[model samples]
Target: MRSSSPSPAPPVDLAKARRVAVEAAEAAGDLLRAGMARPLEIRPKGTAGDVVTELDLAAEALILRRLRAVYPGHRVIAEESGVNEGTGTAAGADAGLVWLVDPLDGTNNVAIGMPVYAVGLALCAGPVPVLGVVHDPVTRRTWSAVRGEGARGPDGAPLRLAAAARAGRADNPVLAWTQGHEVGRGDPVVLPLRTAVEARCGRLLQLWAPLVAWVMLARGDIDGIVGYRPELVDLPAGALLAKEAGAEFRALDGGPYEPSIDLPPAERGFVAARPALLERLLETTAQACRPAAAGTGSTGGTEGTGGSAGAGGSGGAAQGGRVRLTR
Candidate 1:
């Protein structure tokens, strides 16, 4: 990787792109919803908990078609279908743009008739996510956000948590936990971190469906999210959504989260919460990751906003936001 910060990306018609992404995600979600009640040809993608169904493939194809039809020059990465190098790549070299898609984010839940699932998509300019759209066909709700813009729900209004919801109750905090597929149950770093957080929080939820958990966090239904090396495919969209919804996505070392499509798995985990709850979340994170950071654990390295993280400056508000909303 280059040892220098990336130059600023030129502005584009991101509003139009956001519309296209929202449409694609919703359409794919509709497909998933329609197929949910039917018998699925489910198969293991890898570990026992990870699975894929025919609906996942169908939904991905539906979303990919909508996306390619609009931006054929942009790179497209989908969960089920292979990457479309087209005129761009995830490296953002050709067109300096990439789209990340997870047409059915909760395939395991969907396979088992669980009502929690969503269709997710994101647009990245170089390494930074500029737009994100996540749709839940079951509830017919869609959440979207542009990099500098605030997050929005299906009603097209900014998503703001009530004061009570934003408060992280010291005695009853609820948190969502996410882990990458590669991290085994016995992972040294994850096991310790998970144990620590679980002990403190009144309730700990690990949905395996990260996008769903992200929505819960963004909407302030949960206190925070403690992701232990989440997948890149699901990270860009959900992280953008939460950040725009007046929440912060911070590295375990308390550095600002400047996500890149190129970071190593060890660098991808984070803690997300509204500012009111950030310090507490960070305190928990620091305590949990202290041992891991001393070794070769997933979240060991100190993260810089530039250089290896592929950012030139802070990509957050008021310096980094566009569609600003008062907290």
Candidate 2:
């Protein structure tokens, strides 16, 4: 509940949130890489357990008509027009500047072709997400961020975002999980990321977004990342680009990120590694979002906000590891 209205930090240029999210994430990554492997109309959104295609409303109508043709008083909380300019329950300072579109994060791995998927854009002025882009258009690669003039890639180049609080102990550390948390009974956070990726022998990459694992932990190439179901359109531009790339975002119930457009869809989230491995991965993702295990296996995808890839993952590799935790 912290919004005393001061957050104007970081780079925050608002370069129209990187030219309207890199032209709607490269036109929704060219209609998801020309319908990768082909055939997809899909369609289902809640009872069938959510789904949609036509390239997510053609990339949410080209990112809501290019952000209402240059911030038309800016207001958009998307995942498909849930709230555009006004309605009810849509709060991001009632539109002082908002556009948290996830035009196509990982529509179930882009309907199974598995190019990973991505196209997230953040730019909130009221609830404090200064600006962020995450395009991947199947490797066209973007990844912008701007809260204190940091986070950049593709065309702009400059990607560093690392603050690393010197805690040490990440042997392999490229872990991320989400698919079993309905109030725990079985998911004590996948037994500490399968015990820190089998005690650092690591290499179990699964991409489903979480802002492309916080832009591969600000390009350090994923020393640590974990998520259990986060939203607020997936954590304010990758938690301010993993705190300007010095990483460490906790909330296995430690709680804080309170930006809402109506918030309650059964809230859940977690992130770890970087700061004593995020206090033991937030105590194993808060025992896997407790409630004595409501479902199981954490399922997979949506909720790790933002987007992109072209290098990053498996914790520490980046000369071109080509990482993209989720589109």
Candidate 3:
């Protein structure tokens, strides 16, 4: 006999989720800010340029504590510590709830006293993010969003992408690209795409911080952002904020971005741009990825519905040179 389909998970309370995310982010931000005042002992992680300090661990611990207090049974994926199967609950029952936390998004920047860093958190029901919060301790600014409620700035003002588009500065749109160590070496599509974007946009800003870039995009401080090989903790909050603020998110190959915890690290890259500029930017990126002999064709031009073909493996580059988006 055939088995019946599984029951759907209960509806998520987005407002409550947002509150939890905000509380965790703010609490983590405070810890980071306080820690930044003192001298830190920095140590390298997996790479020479990739480093972590005591504060990173401390901040993550604080965030995990805050989240677990409210959601003891939900799974958590954090940067410093890997996955935690909270409360040892059944996998099927906990599949619908997960938290993605990036306690320190710009560790390098913070170590160098650049004052550009953030605490980002996202509450996801399966692959879809329901609530997000990113807090910048240095500037005391916060950016938040609930899936259908829209994004908001620190002052509680609703953020809309048109704010930047209507400012009559589309011609001078600025795009931010990641300068993380993983970008150039791990992802071949990134360098060429960066060159193409730089040539097309008025100016390009290189940022080591993904959360900062996303916040800037949502607040209309920047027109667009593109990142490659982003960590799981770093992208979810930013992706949700950008989507809620009306930014268009797509893979470098102009396909939809499937946000999921199970996605491989190689597939963690995306282009978030204003609606008017998305097509052109995507086409430019696609052209950069195409073989020299193959003439440029229509860049697919499909509206992203958050689904795409699977990435090859958990390697440096995706299979067949096809691009994938993160989180």
Candidate 4:
């Protein structure tokens, strides 16, 4: 005789996923570090000066094999190979658990022997990520975060987001900037925003290596990161890490980045920072968002005095089509 009731769904094991991410990233990083000494093929990936090397393919293959072996029912979206769909029960679920992988996040830098590449691996239950891991092969440094459990560093210590922010007493904070290739280098909106932020900051870095920037932000090495229409694959994991470390990750419209569990990825342009800096960041964003007058080229200007960017909420960015995806 067969059982009458259907079997209960297996629980999503985030701890296991986090462990896998760490191992896979480290493994991929080892391969990437080795490949750096003897690289053969490199090709242009996009118009925005992105490149893909043979190392990228090798690392992705290694990661996919490890991930598939463990969670055969999980979907994966890797930078080199694109999306590989899942099978069996988890595939048919409404939320769709997925792994977003950037096998060689700083491929161009690696190709040039800059030694700044990393392996980014993340697991998400729909748009909300359960964990994120970034591993720097050269330095052997790793930053990881488990949602609701807090973020951790390579030394296995919890990140001191607030204490670190307080310790840094620089009048002008250093900031990292990230934008998708689709946003255009000279985009009118981005230009003014850049000009405004750069004018006030001690420095505004455009590393061309965004995952590195994300790690820096999570580690509190930089004050904040401002992004305009960043990539989906790289965004969620980084955001989760930063948020878990007590940073606020939200939209440029002064709104909460309320990700939908069953919907596609939707974290657009954002200001990610500690609480003390959140209001000021949002103020500057609002000031920058104002329409530029005729013929001044939207250059630099006086920054906002400072105020909370609480609860403004993307103001129809969803319904009014203000926020857009990179793809």
Poorest lDDT segment (10 consecutive residues) of candidate 3: 308-317
- The regions of model 4 sitting more than 4 angstroms off are 1-10, 88-90, 93-95, 163-169, 258-267, 292-327
Q: After superposition, how far is residue 284 of candidate 3 from its true place, in Å?
A: 0.9
**Candidate with best TM-score:** 1
lDDT for model 1, please: 0.68
TM-score of each: 0.84, 0.30, 0.82, 0.81
Model 1 C-alpha lDDT per residue in residues 144-177, reported as the tens digit of each score:
8877667888899988654454344656788888
The lDDT per prediction is 0.68, 0.55, 0.67, 0.65
Candidate 3 overall lDDT versus native: 0.67
Query: Which pairs of residues have clashing backbones in candidate 3?
Result: 259-327
lDDT per residue for candidate 2 within 1-327, as digits (tens), equals 112335564323467567767777778778777766578988755332345678777777777887766555556767655556733343232446666777676676666676766677777665567777877777778777776666677768767644453234255456554322122324344455445444443554556555666666677666666554444464566666556545556555455434332333233344544555666655555554543244433322222221221111111001111112111
Which candidate tops lDDT? 1
So what's the TM-score on candidate 1? 0.84
Off by over 4 Å in 1: 1-11, 47-49, 87-94, 162-170, 297-327
Lowest summed-lDDT stretch of 10 residues in model 1?
A: 308-317
- List the pairs of residues colliding in candidate 1: 148-322
